[model samples]
Target: MSWIVDRIRPREAPSFSRPLALLVAGALFLENLDGTVLQTAAPAVAQEFEVAPEGVSPAIVGYLLAVAVAIPVAGWVAERFGTRRTFLVSVAGFTAASVACALAPNLLWLCAFRIVQGVAGAMMIPVGRIAVLRSVRPTDLLAAMAYLTWPSLIAPVIAPFLGGVITDVLGWRWIFVLNVPIGMALAVGGALLVPRAEHRIRTPLDRWGYLLTAGTVVCLTGGVELLRDGRPWLVATLLLLSVTLAAAAAHGMTRREHPLFVPEVLRIRTFRAGNLSGSVYRLVITGAPFLFVLLFQAGFGWSAAAAGAMVTAVFAGNLGIKPLTTPIIRLLGFRRTLVWSIVAGGASLLAFAGVHASTPVPAIAVLLVFSGAVRSIGFSAYNTVMFADVPRDLLPAANGLSATLQQVGTALGVAAAAAAAGLGTGIAGPEAVELGYRLAFVPLAGLLVIPLVGALRLPAAAGGHATARR
Candidate 1:
């Protein structure tokens, strides 16, 4: 791992070197771009494939599920192979998968391609992050992370607008096609700028462990899908399977010499608490946007363009609030920031239940903007605090575990929203849709209570070094 650190680090700070910053920034941009660009194109893709809009959602499910399955092994792969090789391979695979997705003839084929794309996409963020952490000094780490965060936060904000424009002008295929040039540029930049690591560890691949973890994630995600589809019996069975797989995976990890995730990290109260809270927090945060799209379009009779445009409020608020996040954390501290964020986020979501066609556009926009800002503050702080208590030695494993859970939370959030929207059979058209959105937010808002409690476990100050050693 230290060898990875040495190789992935830049020789000097990149402030003086334009090419280096651009290369890293470009990689980060592509990572965020792929994460969000598909959402705006979903409806168009559904039309092209001649399926229900809900059917196109599987494309998202497949991608996230693939990411969840692949992320755990990413650090291990980097340790065994080297960061440069793994990164290059991941980019190539992602680019090829994007091409395949653009050319896919049917929904099934597109979903398959998306799964491949997801697996490839999963590698970019973590591997790039590892490279960034290794390349920069500790003092510069926050700034480097901020550089990467800019794209991830901004992409989702502008993605809807960009995707809508592309779909309207160039057709939905262009959405995936756009990645071709971006991916190519990033791959070239990475090859040139990122250093190759010499210290390679010969870690044994945990095949059984991998299967168990993968099975658990798949079954859990699939179970959520089934529940949303209203298959009560199947949902129950799948849930049971998911639980069994998770238990087996946990057992396997404990017994193995080199588990996929080190058990010791879980022993740290802050790490464990932070991860649990963050997962629930992410479920609500990620899921809410997807629900908002459906609500605005299907429920309120808004056009795709108009609905997509309104989403810009989130981006605006996110950007506006970022500068204040750290200061707010310093003032209120992490625990207060996290708890209040969850409370504010849940209240904002519940407020959406009152939105109607008669509601003023500006008022609705303000609410969305507020929600986005509060959420950004909460989530960024949660992610930051999780790593605070982690020792340097456990960073890789913790990162892998946290990344996987982040994807899982995202998938689960979307799934939960889907299930909630699926309720109410009698009402049709916009009324039914509005009811679904309303019902969905109720439970989602309630789930925020979990994280509100979880935040209490975070230390008042960073003085729990002894606690972390447990």
Candidate 2:
């Protein structure tokens, strides 16, 4: 009877493999599409609401905060509900939230809707990833992950352009409205295609741990906002509060029988080093685009469409490097590729500080493209290496922790860049805008050094197949 039950389980029986890839890829594309599609629309939204651009920024911040708060809870939700149910719910929720965002009337309403959208979106990619991992064979895993990675990496490159076109032609609201069909399609496909998995052991939800973690993330993110707003005292106070909350949460979680984040996962040396390195690496890489937008629009006095178009160079570079990534990793191995890519990426960013109005557009485009390509190589290598040592049983916990940390790093990077740009403008006046951008790159370059040190701790053959313990 037990054997029959095992044989009858609804494991993803391999069928229509190509369609399976498309379904997963489509889900990933929509997930990334929403992530970046709003950036270019920010200015338009501000104008519509008759508020300052800075005031409108809360839409972005609020979304990010929601994602950060929701990520850790995903593992528990997935465990309680089966993967199929979770994916369907996540996609459906995101679709509904997207409609709410499209119809929002005022800035306040829009911000509120965006938070809902964030909550819904927070589950899409991670749960989708879990589904893919469970469904695909190990040999096919790399290809599946690569397929997902392309959309995510490419979204930023095309987002500004897409957002600008939509806003300029149809209106800013369409950016959110556009997600309606895409989201609906993904939800239906996920329901139909994703296999149901049996819940082997049900772990009780760590409600207290969830609250403490949520509080810590909110406080820390708020502190970053305070610092950007130039409220030094408030920043300090909030930072202290965040520290206290985080410590308290850590203490409490350690005592729990089923902690939200497993302490044992952190004990793995490679996972720890990979996560730490990846977080810092993302700070500079992720934040650089926000700074560049300001540099092009506010400093160089480029129109939104033109500024958005400039990023195509970066996108082109990203695409050009994709075919080469696996081969390069296979050749140089993981550690070497990651290290050199970081150094190369930092240098490219640092070089951007020298760009000026007198600089030819083509020259600038080349530099941007090169930077994008190098970054793609580095990030993929780092992300892949992080999971190499992670055991199968602990994947859920590791994914949650890594995802949360990455979001935190992204928020910090954006805030830090904004604060630095503000300071640069204050001291130099209008002329200082370019210099502010330049100065911002310096520290971002310095951030790469931290990860480089961490990379040193990884084995020389870290990225090779032999290094995978599973």
Candidate 3:
């Protein structure tokens, strides 16, 4: 998330180099892929667990929520513990956790292992980036940073298709089992190649900030999950409490001596605009994939293999658009690029309603691919605008805040989509889950409106600083 992007500043050039950088990037790729691959396998996993496909979402949402909770502390933990130790431990823990996930006997067990995976992931990414920041020279910083950045772009494209293949050809379990080798390789490579720096003078732990922020995420995610449980009063209470806790957390952060995210970062006009818009953007785009996979397998009755294979069209879009992202943003400028991208994304989601059981395969592929390209462009622009205007001293905290909010928004998006589908299923009666899938897109597409309007409000020359450098 923002943690990965935020850490790659132009550091003092190190003789330490890109091998170490690539190794760290490899670790991140595995981490990012782990989060996304689950979407393609959710319907299949649901069958294995004897639950609704939407029911599998708690495991997905739980993992992301755990990552979101753990991310704010990663820098502190890495600094206190040393990046090498933390990174090594994280890779080991994540690999072990993936094994447990593959071996899980029930949904609860699976969700628990995923939470562990998320924690390890939270450690792996920031620590890895911290390692690169310390070791890479200023001259090599761009290449090193680009290596780390690729995972965010590459993983989402291939995860579903790859997850589908692994699930269909091997089993759903192997999709998780696949992480072991990658993690092992990264761990070994990291041990041998990564530089070991002495611990810094560590910052005091922000105990109050940690508790408030973690509590806010937990209660909000719990509230969202409870919405589908058919308990009206409980849902209302949890949601109300989540909002209350969020306000309290905001207050706690502002008053703290050393806040997790400095209060002033939010006051930066460009950062504020980017964060708010990015949240809504991620919520819709990230959640739609979860719903789409479910719709393909559970609703339209496609085989897991078929659904996975076909969904590669979206992956294709993500891949094809990457090289063009910077160029497009530079030429169009941030505001225009973002506004048009959001429009394209919103249109694509709206068009998904036309994808029927009888729709041609090629047509579906084209739609997903085009949508994917549009979404990618918007994401790239938002990430660029995020830190573009922050003063150098505040960049780190601003990046951390951006990363935290990114995960939270993504997790919430997935939850919202699933919960919407669940509620629609209930309203439409049994054997009508497909209708729920279609209805869920209404809100998913609607979320783009927030980012669209936000992007429009930005100055025409927003992100000029970042774009000029690119």
Q: For each predicted model, how many residue pairs clash, with residues at least 3 apart or on different chains?
A: 2, 0, 5
Reference-based TM-score of each model: 0.89, 0.91, 0.86
Q: Per-residue alpha-carbon lDDT of model 1 for 28-98, expressed as tens digits?
A: 56655666678778878999889987778778778888888998888889888888888889999999999
> Can you tell me which runs of candidate 3 are displaced by over 4 Å?
1-21, 39-58, 105-109, 130-150, 153-157, 192-194, 423-435
Worst 10 residues of 3 by lDDT: 135-144
Error of 2 at 427 (Å): 4.2
Local distance difference test values of all predictions, in order? 0.77, 0.77, 0.78
Rank order (by TM-score, best first): 2, 1, 3
Candidate ordering by lDDT (highest first): 3, 2, 1
lDDT of 2 at 456: 77
The positional error of residue 185 in candidate 2, measured at the CA in angstroms, is 1.6
Choose 2 or 3, whichever is better by TM-score.
2
Candidate 2 worst ten-residue window by lDDT: 134-143
Which candidate model has the greater lDDT, 1 or 2?
2
The deviation in Å at residue 57 for candidate 2 is 1.1
Quality of model 1 by C-alpha lDDT: 0.77
